[model samples]
Target chain A: MEFVQNFPFICIILSMFSAIVSFILPGKAAKYLHIGMVTAVLVLSAGTLAYVAGTGESYTFMMGQFPAPWGNEIRVGVLEALMAVIFCIIMLLSVFGGIAHVEREIQRSRKNLFYILLDLLLASLLALIYTNDLFTAYVFIEINTIAACGLIIVKKEARTYVSAIRYMVMSLVGSGLFLIGLSLLYGITGHLLMTPAKEALEKIIAQGTYHVPLVVIMVLVVIGLGIKSGMYLFHTWIPDTYGYTTPTCSAILSSLVSKSYIFLMIKIFFRVVGFDSIISSHLVNIIFVLGLIGMIMGSVAAIKENDIRRMTAFSSVAQIGYIYMGIGLGTTAGVVAALFHIIVHGITKSQLFISIAGLSDVSDGKQDFHSLKGAGFRCKIAGAAYTAASLSMVGMPFFSGFVSKYLFASSAMTAGSGRLIAAWIVLGVSTILNTVYFMRTVITIYTPVDEEMRKVHGISPSKTEQAAMAAMILLNVVVGVASTPIIRALESGLAMFG
Target chain B: MDVIINMLRNHYQDIAAVFLFVIGMTNLLLQQNLIKKIIGLDIMDSAIYLFLASKGYIAGRTAPIVVDGITDVERYINPIPAGLVLTGIVVSVSVSALMMALTICLYREYHTLNLDEIMMKIRKEED
Candidate 1:
C-alpha cells in the first residue's frame, strides 16, 4: 500500500527492464510481453490515479537517496497519474489495433526490435511526464528521439530512411536549442530542479535583473519544443515521417510522440515558469499567433494532399495547433481545455490512422483517395470507424471533438479583451476549414462504385481489429459523454500541478 | 565601454563557445553534403559542452573528487556540468552514428551526398 508512493519509479524501471528483456526474446514472445507490460502499467497507473483522486494527494519520489534540489526526483499528481493511464491505454489500443499490419509490414526478424523501442519510448515518455528536474527531462527527450527514429525505420524502406534522417536532423536541432536553454537557465539559477529553478527565476524577475536572458530561455525552450512537437511553422518533417511509417507506427507517433513533447512544454510553462511570468513575458502571444497560422496552414495543406495518410498527417498538425491555441489563451481553463483536447485528439487521430490502414487494405494498399472509391461499402467496420473519427475530428455535434472545441472556444472567450474577437474568428475559420478537408475525405470514401468494382473490393476487419476499432470509437464517445466528471477531475489535477 | 570590455574579456571562453555554436549552426543549416552536416552536428554539440564546462569553472578550483583531508566546498569546481556533458557526448555519438547510417542508406539508393540532388531524385521518383 505504501509502495504506491514509488509507483512512478516502478513504472519507469518496469518498462526499461522490459525493453532490455524484449530485445532478446522472439518476436511473438516479445509481443505478448509487450501486451502484458502495457496492461500491468495501465493497471498500476489506474490504481495511482484512483489513489490520487480519492485522497486528493500528490506523491514525489526521489531517485536514489539524494534530496530533490541536488538530485533527480519525480512528482506525480492527478494529472500525471491520469496522463500515464491514458498513455498506456492508447499505446495498448493502437498496438492492438494495428498489430496485423505491423506483422505484415515489418520483416520477420526485426519485429521484436520494434516492441523493444516501443518499451524504451514509453519509459522515456513517462519520465518526461513525471521528472521534476530539467536535465532528466533533456536526457529522456534524447531517448525518446532515438526510440522514435528507431520506430520510423523499423520497416526499412527507402522513403523511411529519408524521412528518418530528416526526423533525426530536425529533432537534433530542437534538442540542441533546448539544451542551450537549460544551460543558460542552470548558469543563472544554479539549480535544475523545477521548484528551485522557479524560485530562482521568480527572484530574478522580481529584481528585474537579467531580463533579456530570461526571455531568451523562455523563447528558446518554447521554440525548441514547438519544433519537436510539430507546432505550425516547424512541422515540415511530420508528414513525411508519419506518412511513410506503418499505420501502427503512425498511430503511435501521431498519438503519443508529439503529444508527449507538448505535454512537457505545457508542464514547463505552468510549473516551472508559472503562467503569470509567461503572460508578462508575452511568450504565450507568440505561441498563440503561430498556432493560428498552423491551424489554417495545416488544413490548407491537408486539403491539397492526395494520399490519405498524408492528409491525416496534416490534420494532426492542425489538431496540435488547436491545443497550442488553448495554451496561448493563458488561463487555467485554457490549459485544462488543451489537455482535454490532447486526449480527444490522441484517441481520434490514432483511430483514423488505423482506419486508413483498413481502407488501404480494400484498395490493395493504394493510398490515394481517388483509388479508395466505394471503400465504405466494402469495409463496413473501417468505413464506419473512419466516419465516426472524421466527424469527431470535424467537430460534429455530440462527438468528442465538439466537446473539446466547445471547451477550447469558451475558455478562449473567457480571456476577454483584445484577443477575444481574434480567437473566435480564427476558431470559426479553422473549424470551417477542418470541416472542409475532413468531409471531402469522408465523401470520397462513401462515393458510389459500379457493381463489378464493388464485388472485388471487399475488406473485412478480423475480430480483434473489429473490436479494437469499436473500442476506439466507444472511447471517443465515452470521453465526450463523460466530460463533466473528467473536467472536474482535470481541474483539481491541474490545480495540483505546481 | 571599458568595463563591458573587461567583463567580456573575463568571459572570453563563453564568447568563443557562442561563436563556435553559431558557426556550427550555420554549417548545419547551409551545408549541402550530409557528411558535412554531421560534422556540423558534432561541432554544435561540442560548443554546448564547452559552454557548460566553462560555466562550471571557478578559478583555481580542483577536481570535484575529494582527496585525503581536502574539505573546502569551493575547492572543487561543480562536477554536475561535466557529468551532463559526458551524457550529452554519448547521446551525440549515437545520434551521429544513426545519421551516418541513414546517409549511407540514402547514398546507396541515390548515389548522391547532396541534399538538393537527393530531393530531386526522391521527388522525381515520386512523380
Candidate 2:
C-alpha cells in the first residue's frame, strides 16, 4: 500500500536519472537505456493505476517528510494515475515508432541528445501530471517547454529553427500569463497546493469576496493553457511547428505534450476553481463559444492545407476544439467525454503521424498531397493504418472518435436550448470538415498511378515500427469496442475529482 | 466612484504590474525586431515575478529568515512567494537563453534580426 504511494516519485526520479545517465553514455548505449527505463516506467505506472483503482483511494506523498501547506507534495488519484499510465504508454510507443527515423534523420552524435531530451520530457510530463504543488507544475512546464524545443530542433533544418522560435514565443506568452494567474491565486489563497488552494478559494467564494481576483485567475488560466493547447486564435504556431518537425517529434507534440497541458486545464477547472466559480465567472461559456469557433476554423484551415503533415497538424487544432467543447458543456458527462477524447485522439493522431512516416518514404520524403499519390499501395502496412486512423478521425461508426463525438453532442443537449443548437452545429460541421481533409488524403494515397512512378521508394518498416503501429490501431479498436467500461471508469474518476 | 479611487490607491503595485504586463505583451505582438520581442518576453516574465514578490510583502515585516528568539508568525513577510519568484526567474532565464539561441540561428541563415524579414526570406526561398 505504501509502496504504491511511492511510485510517483520513483517513476519521476528514475526518468531524471536516466536522462543524466544518457548524457555520459554513448548514443547507442543511451538508446538501450531509454528502452529499459520506459519499460520500468510502464510497470510502475500500471501498478500505481491498479492500486488506485482497486483501493479507490487518493494519496498525497509529501517530499522530505514535510507536511502540507509548508513543504512540497505530489498527489496521485485514480484520474492522475490513469493519465500517467496513458502518458507512459503513448510516450514509449512514440519513441519506439521514431527510433528508426531518429537514427535516419538525426546525426549520430545528436542521437544521444535526442534521447536525453525525450527522457527529460517524459520526466517533466510525469511530474506535471502528478505534482500537487502549483509552483512545481510551473517549473515543470518550463522544463517541458525547453525539452520540446530540443525535440523540435533536433533535426536542425532552418525551417525547424524558425518553427521552434515561433513555438517558444507562443509558449513563453502562455506560461507567463499562467504564472501571473498562479501568483494571483497565491495572493488570495496563501497556499500552493491544489487541495488547500481550493479550500481557500471555496471560502472566498462562499463569502462572495474577492470576486474580481477569482475571475481574473479563471480567465488567465484558461487563456494561458488555451494558448499552450493550440486552441484557435492562439494556434498560429501549430502548422509550422508540427509540420516541420520529424514524424516522431510531431507525434509526441500532438499526442502527449499538448494533451497533458489540456489535462492540467481540466484539473484546474475541476479541482482548484470549483465548478461554481467556473460558471459564475462566465469563463466556461466563453470557452464554449471560443471552442465552437475554433472547431470550425481549424477544420477550415486544415481543408485548405496542401501538405499532408500540415493537414494533420491542422486537424489537431480542430480535435483540441472538440475537447474544449466538452469542457464547455460544463457537466460531468461533458468532462468525461473530454477525457475520453483525450485518450482516443492521442492514439489516433499518433497513428496518423507514424503512418505518414512510412507514406513519406514512398513519396521520396516529400509530404505534399501530390507526392503522396499512389504511395499507399506501395506501403501496405502504413496505408492500412492510415486508413483506419482517418476513419477514426472522421468519427465513423464503431471507432473511438465516433464515441467521443457522440458523447460530446449528447452532453451538449444538457445545456440550454440556444447553446445546444450552437454546439450541435459546430460539432456537425467540424466532423464533416474533418472528413473532407482526411478523406481527400485517403483517396489520394490510394489512387493508382503510372508504373514508372510506382517504383518502390520505401522498404517495409522494421519490427519496432510495425509493432508500434499495430499497438496504436489495436488500442483504438479496443477503446471503441469497450468504451462502456472505460466510460464507467471515467465517470467514477470524475465523480471523485474534487 | 469613491470605491474605485480607494481600490486604485490600495492596489497601485498590482496596477503597475498589470501595466508592465500589457506593455510587454504589446511589444511581443507589435514589434518586428526579434531581439525586442525577446526583451518583451523577459519584461512580461519580470512583471509576473514583480507581481508575485509584491503579493508577499506585508505593511511592516522583517525578512523571512528565522531568528533565534523571534517566534511571532507576523514578524516575517511571506517567504513562499520570494522562493517562487526566484524559481520563476530561473525558468525565464533558461527560456531567454533558448530564445536567444534560436535568434542566433535565424540570424546566421537569413542575415537579419527582424522577424518579418526572416519570415519573408523563408517564404521567398520556399517559393
Compare the candidates by TM-score and give the number of the best one. Answer: 1
Residue A191 local lDDT, model 1? 91
List, for all models, the DockQ compared with the true complex.
Answer: 0.76, 0.84
lDDT score, candidate 1: 0.88
What TM-score against the true fold does each predicted structure earn?
0.98, 0.97
Fill in the DockQ of model 1: 0.76
lDDT of 1 by residue, A21-117 (tens): 9878999999999899989999988888888898897777877868767877898899998899989988998898888878888888988998999
Chain A TM-scores for all candidates read 0.98, 0.98
Give residue A326's error in model 1 in angstroms.
0.7
lDDT of 2 at A40: 94
| Candidate 2: residue A144 Cα off by (Å) | 0.8
What does the i-RMS of model 1 come to? 0.9
For residues A372-473, what per-residue lDDT tens digits would candidate 2 score against the true structure? 899888787788889999999999877788899899988887877987899998888888888888999999999989887677676556778878888888
The docking quality of candidate 2, as DockQ, is 0.84
Off by over 4 Å in 1: A456-460, B1-4
